[model samples]
Each structure stands twice: as structure tokens, then as C-alpha cells.
Target chain A: MTTVAPETVPAAPERAERQRGQPRWWLYGAAGVAAALGIWAILAQMLAGGGGAIQRLASPLAVGEQLASYATDGMVADLRSSLAIFVAGWLGGGILAALVGLLLGRVTLLGRMFLPIIEAIRPVSSIAWVPLSIVWFGFGFSSKVFLVGLAVFLVVIVYAVDGCTRIPGELVRTSTMLGMSPMQRFRNLILPGTLSEVLIGFRVGLMAGWGTVIVAELVAADAGLGAHLMAVQRSYDIAAVMATMLCFAIAGFLMTVVFTWVERRLLPWRLEEQR
Target chain B: MTSKEAEALGKTTRPRTGSRHPLQRIGLPLVGVVLLIATWEVTVWLNDLDSIVMPRPMEVLRALGDLVVSGEFWDDVVVSLTEFGSGYVIGVFAGVVVGVLMAEFSVFRATVHPVVEALRFIVPFAWIPLVILWFGTSLLGKTLLVAYATFFVMVVSAAKAMQQVDPTLTKVGRMLGMSRWRLAFAVQLRAAAPTIASSARAAAAIAWIAVVAAEYVGASAGLGVLIINASTSLQTDVVIAGMVVIGLVGAGVSAVIGWLSRSYLSYV
Candidate 1:
């Protein structure tokens, strides 16, 4: 094996330079203004007997305290429960999506047969499946997994199918010329070629799964972030609600970033391609 | 502001389509669907799956027909459609305005960009409880929730598209003594039409999620309510029927937007 020199890839100094060239202070000023405006809007709405929504938002310090207490309190356990469900559901869905996508992508007959039903069902939001999930699996992990699985399935399949259909004609012809069997070509070329695109689908699916989970938890859930937030809202605890949403937003961002990092590490060659 | 510049700018942008056999383009998806339904029927018959748990295709169709004939179902459809439509239009408006502003302004993009990105990652349906608390199960509440869901998605897409406008077009407009406002409206906006159209399609899907979630909460009339009611009653077929309608409506909206996007491309 020969080592490929890093410099063999295109330089990325321009991207860094562009970032440096952009004015940072002005952007922050505008953002500060926007945040102030947002605060003002909430305050205005709350001050005029807005029923304390603004009053609730006014005490970010209090909310920050609440967040600290929540972090120490059952928040960790609650987050764990939700995260556990999220991981289980996402993994199950990811595996199924990848397998189905590969099969449909590789087999012409299977691709032709399943394309219509898949397309028809693809557009349906996973939230629409909540009722059916509740019916089939009851109000538990099974239902959550099913909903997550369904939502992820559609997105992944679409990307995977597109990836398969995008295989270069010349590559396929060359593989066949080398006496590669249909199965061999699928295993060696089609699947590998589509890996990057399929990974993108997985990322999209994971985020979509988060949204689906919220809906699922809304309908019937004993312990989860969604249920937790709903509890705070019902009690008119606006500060707590906002705090929970903050936690959720932060967690979601971190999760997506982690996935991106993992993708970069796994597909180091992508950097070269991008350059 | 200048017709000559517009015409020249338009000539540089063209769509490239990949090659595919016409038969495979249209025939495969159609044939695949028929075969899938056939397979579904066979599986149900062979396994004797309970209709309550997993309804046969015919049962689902029959249930759909029954619902379509009912006035209540029509009411639900109307409610869902109105919520979806109003929310989508408002979301697109807000998205486009903010996207354009952020793209055109340098400082504005930097400071708020992080916040917008953070908000985008937030689960859309998680806003439902707060919306209910604020607006109290009203039409306003649901519409707000839908708008919240789609707004970030469309804004990000639109803003990125705006940034990608050919600098040369802006240069040409400037050479012709075009004002910044005119250049933005006549050139940047038109150039970003395709991207905006794609974003709108994505926004529709996110909007659908929001509408359904809103209905699932405390909605009195909507397909979401019907599905929940059907589920409770163990009317799996009716629930499936609702799913079918939602999927079809989504596809229909996307197809229309896609056509409009193409039309806009030609116009520009």
C-alpha cells in the first residue's frame, strides 16, 4: 500500500481566508439587535396582561437557575430515558432503511416493483403514523421505534434510490466487461459508490426522527423530553418550558454536530473530493 | 431595472438533466406500485392478518371511499388544508424576507446565523405545548406552530441560495448603473428562484408535520383528529385512509411547486 500525500488534495486555504475576511463584529451587532428585538416583542406581549409569558421570559437568570436545578434533578434520568429511546429507534430505522435501500437499489425487478408504493408513502409525515403506531404497539417503546423507523425509512430510501440510479454508465459497463456478475457488481461497486449519499440520508433521517419522537411522545409518553416539556406548559411554567426547549435545542445541535464529525472521520476522502 | 442585462444573465444559467430511458422514467414507478399492492394482498390473504391491526388494501380503499362520502371527513380535510395552506404561505413569506435580508447584509448574517442554526435543530413539534399555552388551542396557535416548523428550513435554504447568486450578474448590473435594490430584486431574487422553489417543497413537508402535530394536540376538526379517533376505536383502515390522503396531498403540493419552479426558471 502507498501513502497518499495530504498535499495531493486541493488547498482549503481560501475557505479559511474567506471566513477571516468576513466582518465578525457587525454580524454580532445585528444578532444582538435581533435578540433585543425578540426580547422586546415578548416583553410587549407579556407586559400588556399577556398572562406572564413575557414576565416569564424576563427572568432568564431565574430560568438559568431552574436549568441548573433541572440538570441535577430528574432531568438527567429523564434525558437518559429519551436518549435511550432515540438511539434504539434510530438504529432500528437506520438498519432497515439501509437494507431496504440497498435491495431496491441493486435489484432491478425489486426496484421496479417497490418504487411506486415507496413513492406513494414517502411523502407521508411520520406524525401521521402516530395514531397507527399507538394502535399497533400501544403507548410504549414499540410505538416510538415504529414511528421513528417509518420516518427515517422514507427519506433514506429516496436518497439511496437516487444514488443507485446515479451510478456512472461507464463504470457499470467496465465492471461487466471484467466478467463481474450482477451480484458482484452490486456488492463491489453500487453499494460502495452510494455510501456517501446514503450516509447523508442517515443524517437527515436522524434529525427527522427527533421531530417524529416529539409527536410520538406528545400522544402518549410517560418519560421523555417532549412529555417533560408538556408537563411544564400545562403548569403554566413558561420559564421551565423555555429552559427545557433550550436543553433540547442544545442537545439536538450537539447530536447533529457529532454525526457530522463522525461522517468526516469516516469519510476522510470526502475532504479531498470537496477540495 | 435593465432588460438587456437581465437577458444576458439569464442566458448563462441552464438546467442539466441526466439521461434515463423514458420507459424507466415513468413506467417503473407505476409498475412497481401495482406489484407491491398485489404482494400486499397476497400476504394478507395468506397470513390472515387481522384488519384491525393491519387492514388489507381493499379494506383501506373502502374505508377511504366511506370517509370521502362523509361530510365530517370533508370538514376535516378543509381544516387541515386551511391550516396547512395558511401556515405554508406565511412561513414562505417570512423565510424569503429574512433570507434576502440576511444574505444581502454582511453583519446581519454573522450574529444571527448561529441563533438561526440552533433554532433549526430544535424539534418543530416541541413548540406545540408552548403555542397552546400562548394561543390556547385556537386556529392562530396551530398556524403559528406550522409556520415555526417550516420557517427555519425555508430561510436557511433561501439564504444559502441567495448567497450563491453569480457575482458576475451583480457586477453587470452595477456597470449599468443599477441601484442595489433593483439589482437585488431583478437579479438576485430571480436567480435564486430554483433554490427557493426547492426550499418551499421541503417547507411543505415540514409544514405537514406541524399541522398534524397541532391537530394531534387539541384539534376539534382535522385529519389528525380523525386518525386519533380512528385509532382509539381500532379503525385501522380509517387511519390508513388518513395516511393515504396526507401522502397524496404532500406529493400533489410538491409536484405543483416543482412545475412553478420550472416556470420561474423560464421566466427569469
Candidate 2:
């Protein structure tokens, strides 16, 4: 493996020289984006000009103007509520999944016993649970949270179990030989080793949670981004609907960036290998 | 202890060889299912809960049987399947075309990246309102929703797969006097096949989720419609039965995708 590293050593200087010109690449990317946006704006304007139901499609400018006004139009309350439910559910599910996964992974026999059932249940979409959730919890905050949390839990548990079970056999053997008890081994090796993988699961789970919360809100909610979307749609306010969608997209992008930053901070030793 | 000592100890303590009977492997999972059913039935019986809140396992099973025997159930199944299948096929086809173009041209990739990245964040469900507005509650609307949901996922996956194709392989093909088009098809596409296939399977699942969601919002016939109707009527058993069908269908779709990939890409 170490010998393989030297094979690419001669190309390093060439790659560095190419990297030095990356700012010019960014300029090209910016131009490309501008061109794409221009095309979209033209298309939207053309569609809007066609009249009839085609007029229902908001022009890009209209959507942008609506997005700007959303902040002052009392939509912030709905955004806050959605974020609250999303965070609460994600954290609740993640913590529970991690704990359960660790326990299950440690007890190999139990893991094996439950693995089939878990897998069978895993393929069932979170949306499938909406009816049952509604029946069980009614149309309230808890139902939405339950639906979101269940989706997150299912995803995170798999990651946690995989992280735990993938501990190197050599590490375990060495620890045992060093007279470290099971508890000590878990604290010193298992926990740290598993955190990196668990964090990855959490990252993915967070996205799943966000998506599920929106779905839950769409199905049943007093207030949230999804509800806001439906409300705007019912009124034939295409611009507001588009603006709401932009909010979701922006929020998702920001959340992913934040999660990734946190992940790097938490697992400083984990180096991402280039494919 | 030294590394050698630890290695020796690890080998000795490792679980024994896989000598269990095949039946035992199958039997355990069956036992687990049976245990779950038993627990569910017993708990329902002991609690004497209303069927509306939580139906008994037996009731749900009966409902499932009845549903399978019903003409309406089959109709809904056919309608949902048609929408899902058509939308998924169209979406995958379009996504692969766009993804290939993007991967082949850096300018195209850069132009599309920002727009796609922004739109990809919106969950498939979030598109329901807009789709319904544009296309109404017709089959076209539902199909478009499914297609829209799957399109972005497929695009991202296919683009990533194409980008990951080894440059050396392309160079090798060129050296062998292969035409550029031939090299792309034979070398690059084949290299990306596994990833593309896996992503297709994932997109299929998203398509299912999207179609069901679209139906929940508005549809004349489908499993989602059945679920919404049953839930509104407080028929928990029917709702569960519908869910079971959805899960089975989803699992079946993925299993088929997996089989196709394994057989077609046996070299991988």
C-alpha cells in the first residue's frame, strides 16, 4: 500500500500547478450559472405569456419578489415551527437509534435474531406510516414528530449497528490481551471507532428527517412549510408556492453545510479519501 | 502480549465455521416473524383495544385477503403500477441522457449544477402542490410527480457514476483505435453500470414514495387513495393492508432490480 503511494508522486507537481488556476475555473462556473438562470427566466416568461392555465406558472422574477417579502409576511412563524419539529424529531430518533444500535451490535446473537425483521420493516416507506400515525397520535405536533423520528430512527440504526460490528478483530484481540475489560474496551475503542460512522448515519438521517417532516406536515399539520405550500396552492398563488419551495431548498442546503462542518469538527482524525 | 500472540488468540476465539443447516437459517427468521405476530395478537387481545385504534393481527390478515380477492383492489393496483412504471421509466431515461451530457462536458455540468443542486433539496412531497396545480388530479399529474421525484436522484447518481469512470480506461480504449462514441459506450458506460443500476433501484423507491404521496393528496384510484379513504373511515385494518401491499411492491421492485444487475453485470 505504501509503495503504491510513490507511483503517483511524479504527478503531484503537475496537479498542484493545475490547482493554482482554480480561480479561473470558478469564473467559468459562475458564467455557466448565469447563462442557465437566464434560460430559465426566458422559459418562465414564455410560459407565463401563453395565458390560460399556463399563466399559473410564476415567472422567475415574481417568485423572487415573493421570496423577498416572505420574511416580513408572517411566514417566519411557520418556518420556526417546522424547524422546531424537524430538530426535535431528528435528535430524539438519532440518540435513541445510537443507543439501541450499540446494544444490539454488542450482543451479536440478538442482532442476528432481529436483523431479518428489521430489514423487512426497513423497506416500508415512512409515508406508509402516515395513516397509522394519524390514527395513533391524531393531527398534532406529536404525530408529525413521530413520523419524522421513525424515518430517522430506521436509517440511523443501520449505520450505528454497522459501525459497531465493523470494529477490527485485531483491535478487540489486542485490547483483551492488554487486560482491558469489556467496559473499558467499549469506552476506549468501540465508542471512538463508531463515532465517525455514526456521524455519517446522522448526516444522512438528518436529511431524511427533514424530508419526512415536510411530508408529515403536508399530510397533517396546523403550520409548517408544507402546510404553507398547500395553503398557497389552494389559493392559486403560484409565486408564493415557488417562494416556499425555494425556502425549503435553501434550508436543506444550509443544514447539510452545517452538519458537514460539525461532522468534520467531531471526527477530526477521519480523512476523506478521494475517489 | 505481542501482535503475533494477539493474532493467534483472535483466530482461536473467532466464531466457528459456517456449518449450520440451511433450514436453521430460514427457520430463525420465520420464528422471529411468528413471535412478532403472536405478541401483537396477544397484546391486542389482552388490552381489548378498539379495532379503530389498533386492529388485531388476524383482522389485518383477513383484510389483506379480502383486498386481494376484490376487483377494486386489483384495479387500484393496476392504476398505481401503470403510473409508477411509466413515470419511473421516463424519468430514468431522461436522467441518464442529461447525466451523460453533463459528465461529458464540463460547461454543461457547471451550468446545470447550481439549478439541480438547489432543486434537489426539495423533497418529492413538496412538489405535490405545484404538480397538482399544473397538471391537476389526472394520471398525468401523478406520473409527473413520480418522474420529477426520481429524475433528480437519478441525475445525481448517474453523473457521479460517469465521473468516477477511470480516465486510464478511456485512454486505453483510444489507444486501441476505438472511436470516441464506441469508447464511451463500451468502456465508460460499462464501468458506470453498477452504480447506475443501484441508483436506478433507489430512484424506483423514490418514485413509489412520490406516486403514493401524489395519490394521497388527490387521486381517484390507487393504494394511497385506499389508505386515505380507509383512514378517514377509521378502518385501521384496511389502511394497514394497503401499507402491506405498498411495502411488498416496493420490495419486489428492488429485488427485481438487484436480480437484473447481478445477472447483467456478472463480471462485476
Candidate 3:
């Protein structure tokens, strides 16, 4: 129930001025009109396109039907397998990244010595590592995990290092003044401070990991949502493709929302900021 | 305390080696890299991994040499670069226009922003199938997918930057009797230049992702196709070589863009 200072609220003036200029109902009205128009456009184009631009858009109802059929046709198994690999790989990358980030961030010599090398590796996209991953692990979960790991690893490490480096010097000084040991200081202050940032990294890493997994699966795999979409493409089943895509989109969005919820629950101080 | 614990504790308490010789700084990382490569080489040998499954670094270097001399390597590079350039241009053009319009018009912002945000959740690769169905696996399809992916990210960033423009700049322009249109275009847009430049740089990274994904699903030529083909054949060395080339090209483009932005758009 902590309140932000009035001066700290950047949007307050703008919000007040905006409120005076237009009623809140007008915004809802405009939004409703736009949504109605969009739906009408979509429906008209879908139904009336005997041969036109609207006809080119895939049928949403058909896509939904294909998705239900796909569930009974073994796509559910492929999805489960992909999720298993993604979870394992994401955890592995997160642990490795945090460890490396801590080592580099704490050790001044290591940070200076390896910063350039890390920079070089940072720009090396995981898509660029697909060839190597396949070569090392073959067309298996191993390959997919390796590719996903590469994508998540550097991003998380960079965030972790930044978080550690940016810790306030006065906070460290205060701990020292309290006669805290090195380990005690880290456990109580540094680790907790860095945890919030690391969590942000994990959230972003999950999305990047998913992106890499899909692309890797598309290029080489025999299963997964990407592979399922590919099969639909081969058969000219646009509805199934769209359906599978919708599933992936929903999965990604839900995963993000869940992560945000977890973050809010775990870090109530941040939630306090929202008020 | 145990030696492990002692060493861990000792890390923070030691007299800080805050400054060091240049060679010492360079040497440690060089050794780490050499050790890494040595470990990789030894693991492959001990595991008896076939060269096809896991080629030695030397084998990858040899593949790199072969590709360097071959014309096809350059041709694929050219094709990929052409697609990237044309698609990126169209995407940025569309993105800036849409972003400006959205920023200027609150109605468009409310409706279009939701749609755009929802679309961002869809991975670019998902568009591969749809694009193929509509554009038939042509260069048009690839470009369209690339543009589709890049456009949303750029537009979101640009519109956000416009929103963040200093209100004072607009107010000053008004006080100077500048017309509303001129004030928006000249003052607000100029104020948002730094954000636009940075977002454009980020857009390049996104563009790279989109291009590779576009090629992965269906493309006659490109680094994605090159790597996919190499992997299918179990040509580990060639696959590694392709990766090196892609990494180099991507990094080079980003560095060039950074330099150009820094030099020409100093205001940004």
C-alpha cells in the first residue's frame, strides 16, 4: 500500500490533461468502432472472396477445425516432446549463465580479460550455431536443446553480469560497515539484488529459447510444432498451418503471462511500483 | 574452512588487482580459448565421434578455405545480402510511416497497437507457411516474411520513441510561431532521433533473425538453406564453415550499421 510520490509519476500531468480533453467513453467508443470494422472486413473478405484479396486470407473456422483434428493426430505428442526438451535446455542454460556471470562479474581480472571475447561470442546468433548443434547432437532432442541453450545462454549471462556490476557501491560499503563477511554480504545483498535482474533475463531467455527451438525444429527435426507446420505446408493445408501457428502463439503468450505472474508474486516490491 | 570455501571467500577479500599489465589481460583469455578448443578436440577423439558427426576444428578450417575459393559461396552470400537489404528497406519505410501516423492519431494508436502487439507474439517462422501459400515460395514470399517480422518491431519502437519526445520541444516550437505540422515533423521527430537510431540498430538484429527463419522454411539460396543442406548430408565440417560465414556476415553488417549511425547521425 506504499504510494509513489506525485512528482515521481511522469504520466500524471498528461493523464489529467488527456482526461480534460476527452471523455473516457470516447476511447472505448473508438475502440469498439475499430474492432467492429476490422471484424466486418475480415468476415466480408472471407465470405465474399469468390476470387479476391480477402479470399487469400485463410479461413479461421477451418484452421480451428484442423487444429482439433491435429490434436487427435499425434501433434499433442510432438508438442509434449518439444516442451520437455525446452524445459531441460532452458534450465541448463540459466544455471550455466548465472554461474559464468557471477564468476566474471566478481572477478575483476576475469571481467577485463574475457569482456572482449564475450562480446565476440555475444553477437554470434544461435541460428548460426544450428549447423554445429546438428553436427554434434544429430537430429534429436540433443540437437534442439543445444541450439536453444546457445540462444538463451549469452543473453542471460549478459543480463546477470550487468546486474552484478550495477549494484550500488554504497550498499557494499554499508554491509562492510555492519561487519559482514564476504559470503554473508553476497548472500544477503548482492544475490537478492541480482535475483530480480536474473529473473528478467530468464523471462526474455524463455522467449528466445522458444524462437530458437522452432527455427531449429523447422530446419532439421522430424517432430514439434514447426515440423507439424512444415508437413501442413507440403500438403497445401494452410488451415492446419495457421492453426498450429495459433497454438504456438498462444503458448508463447501464456508462458510470458505466467512468468510475469510468478515475478509479481515473488517480487512484491515491483508490484508495489505498479500502483 | 575447506580449501574450496577458502578460495571462494578469498576472491573478494584479497588486495584488489584493479590494474594489470596489458599482456596479462590479453594472455588469460587467450589461454581460456585455447583450452576450450583443446577440450573440444579431445572429447571428440575420445568419444570416437565420426568426422561426419563432429569434425575437428582443422577440418572446419579446411572447409572454410574451400568455400572461400569457390564462387558458389559468394553467390549465396550475395543472394542472402540482396534479400536482407531489399526487405529491410521496405520494412523500415513502412514501419516509420505507420509509427508516425499512430503517434499523431490516438485512434489509430489504440486499435492498431493492440493488433500489432498481438501479432508480435507470433514467431516469424510461423509466417513461412502462410507466405508460401500466398506468394508461392518466391523471393517475394521471403521478402514479405522478412518485412512482416521486421516491420512490427520497428514500428513499435518508433511509435514508442515518438511518444517519448520531449513535450518542451513542441511547446518551444509553438512559442516560436511554428505551425503544428512543422513543429511535429521538425521538433518532435528530431528529438526522437536518438531512440530511432538505437531502435534501427535493434531492428537489424531482428531482421537477421527474420531472414534466417524465412530461408529455413523455403528458400532456393541463403545461409539458412546452406546450413540445412550441409546438416542433412552430415557434412559437419561444411556446416561449421557455414556457421562461421553467417556469424561473420551478421557481425560485419551490425558493425557497419553502428559506425554509419554514429558518424552521420551524431544528433542521434
Candidate 4:
């Protein structure tokens, strides 16, 4: 009982309170953003000169107008298709990696035997797999999904294996002494212990999957945000390209914020350690 | 120590299943890879899959050999390596400087933080269209794309590292009569080196990936170009060979970074 005493846990509340007092920080952040935008607008105007606007760099105002127009256009469908591929690949890759990682972590011999093979393939960039995936599945939704899954799988597996292997020997020993069966111990301790790390892996995998989906779409696709981007690029519509990029940036940001919120709610104990 | 004490210590330290021999540790993974190749070959043979869809392992190996013997392969490799190296170096240098400035100056930090945060959400691939438009498939374009990707990654990590430096260390340096510049260079930078080194490694990997993506989109020469060209011509074997080369180069770069971190930045 003495060994299990919570020593540093009490300090977290005070630190959290200190962070809560920082209200002026938001104003400063907003001011900074405003200044940056002003500078960007001025720079864009300067770069565009008078007559022939640089077809490469679109002015901020032009991009903004395009963004507004696109909002009324087929932006929603593009987003939905991209998100569908991203979510499917992320879940498929993450779940499969977690299960395989758990098995490998529990069996030392299997880890030793197969880890090198896994490591060898992990460095192959997801973009490198585009040709093979296209050849296998053709130029369709499945090919992009396969490419995204392949991209995410390696990252998730690496993190999942790390999480599983890092379980403390002392915890296992203590549970064994308390007369817990191996299966029960695994259920109660190992699974819960690995959840935090697996979630982190999932977050990383999600970002990688998102990037892969975009790359996959760029190669060969009829729809999706990437295909839209390619179309604009071919037409030399700089403003449209910028608008599409902004869409990607915003979607990615919102997804990450939501993920962080979920992760925080699910793993309350991790907050103190993070601080 | 007594023999009994030594035995108890050994019991505590050793794994429950007993330590594996070195040969088993290394040889088993090799065996696993060989088995995988064998399985792939057998599956292709049994299914009678077209070489266009999936080239046999032997054909891939032959393609790899031909690539090595050809001058074009060397040119592509050299171009890719140059882009990766130059972009990585420039990105790391700029990122570290900007990150240090942000961490040290509140005004700078507040001004840059919002823009950086917003831009970070855009994946490197999303910049391909703009990059091509701006620089037009030139070496400079590819290098800038790689640098852009690396810069954002390294800046965030470096800034975090700098901010996490213990305030007490700076105070101690001041007490010892160190100048502001001296304290920052000698104390804060040293303390943050390990974190910065790790971020640099990550940036290196991202740089490699960015270069490939750039080349894929609009490059006259590179491994990515080879892959794209070969695939279009139904030269699946050459495509696989290009992939193998890319993977090997990536692994080599990572290994070099790992070695450097272990040898120089292990203090943290």
C-alpha cells in the first residue's frame, strides 16, 4: 500500500489552475494571426504587380472569393468521399495492427522472428505502393483505400508493439502474486495499460492515412479533394488550388482537434503525466 | 559478492524464459524473410498470375541487377540523394533558428504561432500543385517542397524542446556570470540537443518522402519518375526495383541518423 501511494498527483490540479488564469493569451494569439494575414495580403498584392497576375501565387482576396464559391459548389461531396476513404483505411489498418501487435508482444519468439521482416518493409514510403495498389485494385476507391491502409499499418504496428512491450514486469508479478489468472491479468491490466499508447498510435496513423489518401487520389481518381486539386492545377486556376488546399487544412485541423478531445476524455490519467 | 547473492541477482535480471542465443536472435529473422519470399514465389507460381500484375521475385532481382548496371539508374539515385541532402540541411538550419527565436521572444512566438499552426494542417502532398506552378519541375522546386515539409516538423519539435528547458538551468548560468548569448548557446542549446536531434531524424524521413512525392508529380528524373514510367509501360519488375531502391535508401538514411544520435547526442 505504501508503495502505491500517489506522491506527485496532487500537484497537477495547481498547475491546471495556473494555466486557466491565462486569458490574455487568446488576445495575443488573435493579434498575431491578424498581423500574419495582413502581411500575407500585402505580400500577395506586391507579388502580383499590376497587369498580369502571377499564375502561380494567387492573391488572398482571389482565393477567398474562390473559397466562398466552392462552399456552394460540390465541396461537401468531395469532403465526404475523402473522409470515407481516410476513415476506412485508418480503422482497417489500426485494428489489424493492434491485434497482430498484441500477439507478437505476448510471444517473445514470434517478435524476434518476424520483427526484422516488418522493419524492412516499414521504410517503404506509402507513395511507393501506389503503383502496386493501382495495379492490384485498379483506379478506384479500393486502390486509394489500400494505399492509405498500407501507409497507416506500419506506423500503428510500430507504436502498438512498443506499447505492448513496455508493460512493467513488476505489474505482472504483483498481479500473479494476487492470484490472478493469466487471462484475467491480461484483461484487467495489459489491455487497459495499452489503451493509451494504442490511441496515440491511432492518432498518428490517422494523419498518415489522410496524407496517403490525398497522394493516392492525385495519381488516378475521378473525385475527391485531391482530384479537384489536380483539375484546378491543369487549368492553371491558382485561386481554386489555394481554396482546395485551405479545405484540406481546415478538415485536417478539425479532425485533429476532435481526436485530441476524445483522447483526453478516454485517458484522464495521462493528463497528469503529460503535464 | 557471495555466490548466493550473485545467483539471486541473476534470477532477478534474466528473462523468465531464459536469454536467447545471439545466433537465434539474428538468424530467425532472416529465416522469416526467406520464408516470406518463398511463399510469394509459390503463390504466384500456383496462381499463374501475369508478370504485368505481379512480377516473380527472380524477375524483380534481375530488374534490380539491370538497374544497377545502367547509367540512368545512377543518375536518378544521385539526383534524389542531392535533393534529400540539400533540402534536409537547409531545413534543419532554418527550423532550428526560427524555433529558437520563437522560444526566446514572446512577440515572435505569438506572431508566428498562429500561421505555423494553420499551415501545419496542410499535408506536404497538398503543396504539390502550388510547388509545380511556382518552380515548374525544377530541382529547386523539389528541394523547396522537401524543405517546406521538413521545416514545419522540425520547427514545432525544436520550439517545444526549447520551451521545455528548465528555468533553473538558466538561473544557474546567470549566477555563474555567463552572458545571455553564452548561456543560450552553452546551456539551453546543450539541454535541448537530444530532442532537436530526434526531430531532425523525423525531418530527414519526411524530406525523403517529400522528395519522392515531388518527383512523382513532375520530375524529369528520379526513382519516383522511374516507378511512374515503368508502371505506365507495364514494366512491373522495374517498378518493384525502384521501390526496393527507395526503401533501401530510406533505411540507410535512418540508420545513419540513428548512429549519429547514439554517438553524439546520448547524454540526454
Instruction: Specify the highest-lDDT model's number.
Output: 4
Kindly list the per-residue Cα lDDT of model 2 for residues B1-268, writing each as its tens digit. 0111111111111123242777756776677688889898888889988999889988999999999999999999888888898898888888888877777766566557656665667767778888878877788887777777767767776776777788899889999999978987889989998888877777777678778878887788988898998998999999999999998987787778778878999999
Q: List candidate 1 segments past 4 Å from native.
A: A1-48, A51-58, A176-184, A272-275, B1-31
Question: Could you tell me which residue pairs clash in candidate 1?
Answer: A27-B107, A27-B111, A113-B32
Cα deviation in Å at residue A145, candidate 1? 0.7
Q: Can you give the TM-score per candidate against the true fold?
A: 0.87, 0.90, 0.86, 0.91
Give the Å shift of residue B126 in candidate 3.
1.6
**Candidate 2 TM-score to native:** 0.90
Residues A3-89 of candidate 3 have per-residue lDDT tens digits of 211111122245436745778635754685567556855874665555533235555567679888988987778788778777878
Q: What DockQ would candidate 1 receive versus the native complex?
A: 0.36
Q: lDDT tens digits, residues B1-268, model 3?
A: 0111111111221113444676766787777677767887998899988898788989999999998999988988887887778887787779878887777766565556545655677877667777867676577777777677668766766676777787888788999999978987898778877766666666666677677767766788888788878877878899888877877887787777778778877765
Q: In candidate 3, which residue ranges exceed 4 Å CA deviation?
A: A1-56, A67-78, A271-275, B1-28, B45-48
Predicted complex 1: CAPRI docking category? acceptable
Q: What is candidate 1's lDDT per residue for A1-275, written digit by digit as tens?
A: 00221111111244336556776654684676678557756674566464543233425565678788889888888788778777777778877777777777667667765665776676677888887777678889888878887876776666676677678999999999999998899889998877776776777776677767777777776888878888888788877887787778777667766776787788888766745
**Candidate 4 lDDT by residue in tens digits, A120-167:** 776678888888988999999888888888777777777667777778
Which residue pairs show backbone clashes in model 3? Answer: none
User: Model 2: which residue pairs collide?
Assistant: none
Tell me, what's the RMSD of every candidate? 6.8, 7.2, 7.1, 7.7
Candidate 1 lDDT, tens digit per residue, B153-205?
A: 66766776777788799899899999999999999888888867766776776
